[model samples]
Target: MKSIDTEKINVGVVGLGLMGTSLIVSLLIAGHKVKAIAPIPEDMEDAPQRIREHLMICEDAGTLDRPVDCYLSQLVISEDYLLLAPCDLVLECVIEIPEIKRSVYKKVEAIISTDAILASNTSAIPISELQKGLFAPQRFLGIHWAEPSYFTRFMEITCGAQTDAVLAEWVYELAHQWGKEPTLLRKDIRGFVTNRLMYAVYREGLSIVAKGDATFEDVDKAFRYDVGSWITLMGIFRRLDYLGLKDAFETYNRLAPHFCNDEQIPPLMQNMVEKNAKGTRNCLGLYSYTPDEAKRWDEAFAAFNVDIYRLAAMYPSQREKKKTRV
Candidate 1:
């Protein structure tokens, strides 16, 4: 119920996969004492090495102030849930399965202090659904982080119906301290805001490809050269307001497809998943590309973020106005 002093807070990340590791390094970079946990003993053993690699990347990107080892020393990796007892905030980033998440939360509840806030990094599951059956559900919420979390400034903070307002505000303030532009969702909503808008674009993009209306390259190029650059700075809604809301609404009504229903997953996407073309992980998707190509795409995305941040910094009034409107 009280605001957390992030500098003094003990943070625990309860998964050692990509997301969990990213959170660990980002929290450490922000000067928080981090306790990182993994389910497997091997994962615990690899944590230090992974942390070092992440720090090296940060150094290469010119984002680190101290030596990697000095930062690594602040992170404590373990396989036992009991090690998280002292943490004031525990972020769960396990597999997306509801049962797995619930099991992790139950374990965390048994170990962490009574007032410790519980958060999930789930992108789709509702926070309320995840908090179901918990004795102190008000402390449970979602702190969804975008992929490559350490590099992305986008963060969505959602609170369940039972979540305390004071705690939500505390988390919002804490996220700002951690160098994230965190947006608080006043109520639990499916996909929150970012994903709701993003997935709408994604679903339509896939539909376009499925209907043979555009090639993958064409769609990528359209976003990259067109709306992508603008959205990076002013987001969709702000850009709409900037361009005149009436004009934006007219365009949306004119171009929005009426038949892009969610009744079925596109055959192309289904086939890709069925064929084990799991995207960057497997180096396959709507279009085939090498691992290096994927890396290039990632670097481009990071560069875009940095450029937008710099531009936004120059226009502080616009950024402040957007915050005020929110």
Candidate 2:
């Protein structure tokens, strides 16, 4: 397939939740004409206002380069799939149900061009399965984004079993243009890379709490002080290399067996779900807080992540440093 060579491409985003909205805004910030579609009419109506508020946030944060109305002018919000017909790319950011995603993909495929890039924002779903029944599966791949996508630099680009290599590479280059430090997975894998690594870390962290070795607060503190210190500078393996890989190997050999090996959902999470615990959103979860306090904490976290994003930029990873020099 030929590469998407245009400086600005027409893109469509299906399922206009926070993710879809953030994506459209980010794409608009990068000068793309976006067609955003949400299932409900009310959500479509509010999408523009939500984007405007986000643009204001970006303006205050000094990230906005152009006027907010410019982005809104480039964006078209609708409930109809036909509006996506002119798109050069379409991203499916719907709920994480296989059948639901397949239905959306089928509908999107019917409306968009045969060669238009079709991507998913799935975190755990395997793209190989998501490509089933597509009119052109070769154009389908996974393009996962993290929360608050417009601000974060993390993106994961994955290829399905039948995905075209050239198209996948094209997406990789496009990701860089989107101002992302995206990892392109050569093979489609369940959980891809981020989720797998994060879950591994979660398993161990939860195991510690379950075993009563530490409280949840202690775990959070440990992460905030320990991993937070250098995670922006280098990843786990790179940090190991900095310390001494042989020493890390020895430590892993001694400690890996003790890490959580349970396949079943831990009671800590299951019980929380049963209780309808939703952290700050519902004022319940690992730690309880007053509603107003919880709201502040949530806002604090949102602002803190932005500041951390800046720190991550300043302490660019070794690869980033080398790339800049070259």
Q: Name every residue pair that clashes in candidate 2.
A: none
Q: All models: lDDT?
A: 0.83, 0.85
For candidate 1, write residues 184-294 as lDDT tens digits: 997999889977877787788888887889988999999888886686667777887788889878877887665486757778778888998977767887777799998
Q: What is the C-alpha local distance difference test score of candidate 1?
A: 0.83
Error of 2 at 310 (Å): 1.7
Write one digit per residue (lDDT tens) for candidate 2, span 240-308. 979988988898899977878888888898999999999888888889989999989979988987897
Off by over 4 Å in 1: 1-4, 256-259, 291-326
User: Clashes per prediction?
Assistant: 0, 0
**TM-scores for every candidate against the unseen true structure:** 0.89, 0.94
